[model samples]
Target: MNNIADRYLLHAAFPLSMDNESKSTTEMICIANKKSVQEQQLLQALESSEQRYEIATKITNDGLWEWNLNSNQINYSSRWKSMLGCSNQEIKNSPVEWFARVHQADIEKLRRNLSACGQGDVSQFEMEYSLLHQDGNYRVMSCKCMAIRGTEGKIDRLVGCQTDITRHKQTEARLNYDINYDRLTRLPNRQLFIKNLQELSQIESSCLFGVLCLDLDRFKYINHNFGHQTGDCLLVKIVQKLKSCLRSGDLLARIGGDEFAILLAGFERADYPAEIASQIQQKFSAPIEVENRSILITTSIGIAPLTNINDLEHQESSYSLIEALQNAEIAMHQAKNKGKACSVVFESAAYLQSIAKFKSENELRAAIELEQFELHYQPIIKLADRQLVGFEALVRWQHPDKGMVAPGDFIPLAESTGLIIPIGWWVLRSACAQMVLWQQDRPKSKLAFISVNIAGKQFSQPYAGDIIAQILTETGLDPRCLKLEITESEIIENVNVVLSTAEKLKKLGVQLSMDDFGTGYSSLSYLHCLPVDTLKIDRSFVENIESNIHELELVKTIIKLAQVFNLDVVAEGIEREQQCDRLLELQCEYGQGYLFSKPLSLAEANNLLESVNN
Candidate 1:
């Protein structure tokens, strides 16, 4: 107050006539009061600003930090220390403290960024890095900082804000994992497998690499018999077994349902892929127990090798990663065709065959639409009387361009593509109608039956019995005049379903014959259980019966077994008189082969029937 009054009095030229002491005292009181008011206002404004800054820091949850470049000291806000789970007293106001809290891997990068800002190369910098927390875990943090310059235009200090992004980072990682991994097996999915293949293709390595495509055999049946829940558990167990067969560096992925693939890299030996496939198959030999049910399964595998990525690229300019996978898949299908539970190595020949098969499948579909198929009937002879009692219907493809295509050329293809279903129905209806026509033409003559071959898939259809009955009603053919022949393998593989189908057909007065018996699973155990009226000896045994005594004995045993079951025997492929005589001597009831007559066209068959009646 004294200095304020003295300065005020010295600056002010008040009236000299008044008492100097009294005027000076009054003026000093006024100046002192005004100075006190100004000082109080300034302090209030400073307090308000500090309160606002604290609220902002709290609202934003941003930890503030200031670094004095000259003194190499850092000032950390209380909030900053608390962000790392530390108290203000626990942290020191020093750059060393901040640097020590940074992750070791991120420390060098942080220093380099800070150096750039200090050198005035950047006005500010933003970086996301890992920071060590007080809980001994690293937290992802996003830091934004700006350099403050001094009067000499040199960096004097740095001020920054750090935000904890640990949750955000975890969410990002989880999303990435979900996209690339299978949910059921936790293995890499198809997308990740393709990505890995692409990455491998980019590497300039001479080491050999390959892919293995595996498919579970009869998995659909398992799914149908057991519920999908059990099937899923089975698949998981299968993954565990497959993993045990893989090398450490190999990658296994579940590409699709019941289909898996393995990527083998850096292997020098060409046979290594086959060895792994064998091991995997061996592991499946033991039955897997799932949900208290012991399930047996096998896999078909295909292997495609990549000897040199560069060479492959050079060979096909349009080469793609998907094509590599497709090639392996094609080989896997080939293995399935050869018989499941085996592995096939991809080759140029197999690729070409796949292409051909694709074309042929399309052609077959078109042919079915255009009705380019016809039935040829082969006469079935009663060996004792040498009389024609029935005819077996065979399918022939009357190709528009290829003249006549034999069943051997396309039957397997038809079976694989499920074309056999429609084609099989067509044969059945045609054969039955033709038999009705023959019966109408010669009402007095007896035509025992017309035998039609039914495919395994067609027979397995639930509505097969109903469909056959409908066809019979439509054609006005006696069910007793139509005999259905199913292969032995088809019957044995699905005995329960086949038995049901057989009972249904039997109710319709249709006879069942086991076609190609003795060629596959000649299980005498199921023979008596089947309600079959006849057993047709396979052509292989009949073909060698003349010269092969072992074949003759097997034929004898088959005939005796048929007799024991009270089932009629039909010998197929009797190409020679000796074979026919031998079959008759064995008491085989019926026979059909070139020795009688080849499969005949409709007009030829009509002529033959008339000749037999005459």
Candidate 2:
């Protein structure tokens, strides 16, 4: 038959009633009808497939496009046209039209990527780029493009899809902003400042760039006096003030806390940093008002000029931005020492001092290694009977080069360098071992206990209880006769960890004393919560108890608070006989100071103990 309609028919009269010629014609009709049904089914399946493809493109938010290589013609789907705020009729179906609409800056990259995909070197082309929209604004698009090869093994046509990704682009920009900026002050943070410093220091090697470190002096006082919210407000105002002092290209960043950093990217003279530091000093001369309160604050500035390194390897090593930052910090300390609101330039001597400090740190490590550290015992007397009840174990370092290095000089370095963990363990082990010896030597006399001062860093150590227990086991010291004097601030910081450790210490039968109680802002919560046996009055209060009424009252209040908590009180630094009488009158149970005798060496302590026993 000529067509499907002629090839088949759906119905015919009964075959038996028809003649031979008529029956053949009727059979042909039936075949034609069956073929027609199959043709209809195939057409329906093709329509279904086209509909599914349309749905997929819509669901994926894809804007599809096709190009004919031979004709140099282009076709765009409705979605593709809508994506760029263009009507189908507005945008011509030409390759030139599409290519021209790509962001001017992105066109060359788009061409390169498209060429790569068309060469069959890549399976597909993918990139995020902006496209000029009909609204005269750029819309970000994720373009996925590919080249389809013909049977002749050549590029037949180009195909691609575009997805609107403006929202994603915006999100990425926001994340980038958050990463580089400080939330509190809206200034470049440490990372961003450091990044810029690295770039400048590397490129402008011959140029002098002043790296200034700015720290608000007595900023902690603001936090304690006005609250952190007020402190935050002060920081914002401080940034504004510093930003005013900077040039457009100069960077001012809030590294953290009340600390800020400034980079003077270019300076005509070497003394410009010192000049800038002076200007800053003058700028902060006036008191700043924050949250309805006029807060008096002074800033200390340290300046270090970047050193030049020509070699690439040395650029990365010898002249690191971090080294410049450290130098600035060293200068800042000198400024602080000079006075608040003062500015100091980095001196060569500061570098030498840092070298000395590093040497001291190494010597500390050596001291710990060579067992050059010693424990001196100061007597803790029972004021009621003048009987020696306990001794405070103080760590002393016998440095080979520096002679006797005081703990005040080295303990801070250990804490800063995280050497306190190992050093602290040694102190604990040494104290425990000494206590064991004292107990063994004086079997008749009742040596109640020895108190070892634990640093804030040491108390923060994980598994503090385990360390203490191990030392006790090894030294054979009775846990009952060992008291750990920890600062009250340590008890309040990190409540969960402190609580767990405190509980473990209690279980281990170790007495806990809150050391330097009145010096820190004491919270009643700590006094009520911690398993403390005693409170040692800070020497600052006890040193001037008679002279300063406020200090005297503070001491009395502390004693009363300890009494309410059922904790014993020990007044430290009691040198005068009058101070001892005053402590007795105040019902203070214990006193430790030079009056009882200075911290004695091990042999001297043993002799003193023998004398007391006799």
Top-scoring candidate (lDDT)? 1
Which runs of model 2 end up more than 4 angstroms from their true locations? 1-48, 86-92, 115-124, 134-136, 307-319, 355-372, 375-614
lDDT of 2 by residue, 1-614 (tens): 21323233222222344454644767878856766787677567766877997787667688999887767787888799899888879888888877888888899999888778777778687898888888899999998888888657788689989899999889998999999998888888999988887676556465556789988999999999889999988888888888878899788888877788888865678678788888888889998999888888998888887544343345364356667787888898888888867888888787898889888788878887898888889999998888998889888889877787778888889887888778888888888888887778778876799899877667767877788888899999888999998887776775567778879989989999988896666567567878889999888888877778988888889889988899999999999988888788788999989988999988898888898999
Clashing pairs in 1: none
- TM-score quality measure for candidate 1: 0.62
What's the lDDT for all of these models?
0.88, 0.82
lDDT of 1 by residue, 257-299 (tens): 9999998888889888888999998999899999999999999
Per-model TM values vs. the true structure: 0.62, 0.58
